[model samples]
Target: MAKLYSKKKLAEAPKMLPKQETIDFILNYSKALKVVKTSNGTYENIAN
Candidate 1:
């Protein structure tokens, strides 16, 4: 649940997008990636 929140936060962070078409792609793609919980209670994306 925390991981999901963090991903949502990251997706919503202030960042410049070059094109409006890419916004959905970025948010959906980021949410789709698998993340692992670290020892420090943070999350890290698992590389494909």
Candidate 2:
């Protein structure tokens, strides 16, 4: 079902953006992690 939102309601909605700390954590974690591609052409995460 399609629900329409009023302009005022949309404007009042809070900005749904990730916090700086969250982004930093994700970036640091990804940097420390390792990844590789398999024969099927798909990525795999091997953090250990």
Candidate 3:
């Protein structure tokens, strides 16, 4: 129960968006949140 979005929780979501789409979304989203991108290229709390 973290106050902010947790990466573990996001991992359980359905992958409606493909890999390429996800990558693009993560990049933009991370910038907005001012969070560093993970090695996997996914932003924290980012759902694919």
Candidate 2 residue lDDT tens string, 1-48? 234553345356678999999999888888877666788886756463
- Residue 37 displacement (Å), model 3: 18
Task: Please provide, for model 1 over 1-45, each residue's C-alpha lDDT reduced to its tens digit, 9 standing for 90 to 100.
Answer: 787666544366588657867888777778778877778786767
* Model 2 lDDT-worst window of ten: 1-10
Candidate 3, residue 22: Cα displacement in angstroms equals 0.4
- Tens digits of per-residue lDDT for model 3, 1-48: 575655456456676756997899778887666445777796545433
Better of 2 and 3 by lDDT: 2
On lDDT, who's better, 1 or 3?
A: 1
lDDT value, residue 5 of candidate 3: 56
Q: How accurate is candidate 3 locally (lDDT)?
A: 0.66
Alpha carbon lDDT at 6, candidate 3: 58
- Candidate lDDT values, in order: 0.70, 0.73, 0.66
Clashing pairs for predicted structure model 3, backbone only: none
Candidate 1 Cα errors over 4 Å, as ranges: 1-17, 37-48
